[model samples]
Target: MVKKFFIFFTFIFVSSLLVSKDITLKAEKEKEYTYKDKFMWLWEKIHDPKSGYLSVEGIPYHSVEKLIIEAHDYGHHSTSEAMSFLIWLEALYAYFTNDWKPFEKSWEVMEKYFIPDKKTEQPNMKYYNFDKPATYVPEYDDPYKYPAGVIYAEPVGKDPLSDVTARYGYEMYLMHWLIDVDDWYGFSKYAG
Candidate 1:
């Protein structure tokens, strides 16, 4: 009778283990399903498809960085950092779902506004000589003497990335350091 009781106890324990295992797996599957839906809505909130950019004041801004900074910046402001996060998140979504559209959309919107057009922004770019990218100035130890001590007389090294820049034909322009999302700080073109 004791042996029979021991076997019955073992059977009950094994049954409970199987039931618990199914519950854990169901929870995991539910979490994954929720995340897939989240990625979809997140893409909708960040960018404007109508204007095809993360826009400001009818002017197309390349990133959503400035707005985030305007909200709260913890003493550091960087558009590249913001863009990096946006791109990374999109890539992660793509990795999980095997969908590249959202990733490509983020990159496209960023480049469309961030990168300066060679024709519009740099009309004189073609005349630029790669051999002399810039005249070098000597470094000085003293802060007061620095400006006076500096001389732009040395020949600069040939620009190594000129070809690469030319291949892409777009110069990155990270400017308007702070984007006033609601025109809160008065960076807007429109005067109130």
Candidate 2:
């Protein structure tokens, strides 16, 4: 009677462990599917060409039109606020496709929106507070200055080759480096 009870308890413990492992694996698989679904959904909404340029919902690409529409829909009409999502989308696309075209396009739009004036002074600055701790505090305010400038050729037609090099040169470089790091490791985000 004692031996039988011991065996039964051991079996139950092993089975419970197996069940827990199975549940964890299933949850991870579901999470992957969810991530892919989100990527696809956003991609489709931004790249649909026709409605894409107009910034309509359910398009598959990014455009000023979509950005404006999204801002108004969300009750914030600021262009910078709208482009924040656009920047993230551009980064995501570059990370996934290992292509720089999306980043270039994003840069073009950003230049048009932020730096439409060609005669702006060099090293023009823009500030973004990321709401994080300051690891290093500067002695002077100038040390904290973040320069914002546009380096793209003036848009003439459909050709973006020249503007690509001028506008997004630094961004393209940083993105290439970041993509390599992300591919090597990984990242996480909370529920959106």
Candidate 3:
């Protein structure tokens, strides 16, 4: 009787060990998705191929439409973040697949939207002077202090990058912060 009991206990322990090993193997299999595939998932969720990521005039709404048409509000931080992620995703895709078209396309889209073109957007940039650049405005800790206190009377140093920026047709390869999309508040509320 004692010998039979010992044999039965050993068989049960071995069976459980095999079952646990199988379960672990299955779990690992489920996580076998490549890093590139994982990155693609983010693009699938937020991007529209035709319109390109819930945008307005090529500027992503941070991502809300003017009339709450979509689900976001205008913010440079949000759009910049999304734009950056898109470029990185495309870069990873190119690395994994060795197809660089998508990566180039991502950069093109980012430049077209965020970095305003010189001739079209900056008409008066030619008049810019390094010595008399826009008045200096110090960063304020208080929220209400801003869009005021522009410190016009105070003298400011000459622009260090004026020479370099002039080579690019006086156009800055930078993305300025946006307050709204489609001029929703201005033309709709102020005009007409």
Question: Which candidate's TM-score is highest?
Answer: 3
User: lDDT for every model?
Assistant: 0.60, 0.47, 0.64
The lDDT-based order of candidates, best leading, equals 3, 1, 2
Residue range 59-141, candidate 1, lDDT tens digits: 33344344434445522222444556667877987887798886787677456544445577667766778887877767767
Separate clash counts for every candidate: 0, 13, 2
Instruction: List model 3 lDDT by residue over 13-95, tens digit each.
Output: 99999999999999898689766667677656555655345443333445433333333443322356666766787788788
Best by lDDT: 3
The estimated TM-scores of all candidates read 0.46, 0.34, 0.57
Predicted candidate 1, C-alpha RMSD: 8.3
Q: Please estimate how well model 2 matches the true structure, expressed as its whole-model Cα lDDT.
A: 0.47
Model 3 lDDT at residue 50: 57
Deviation in angstroms for 40 in model 3? 3.3
Error of 1 at 117 (Å): 1.5
Clashing pairs in 3: 63-72, 64-72
lDDT of 1 at 95: 86
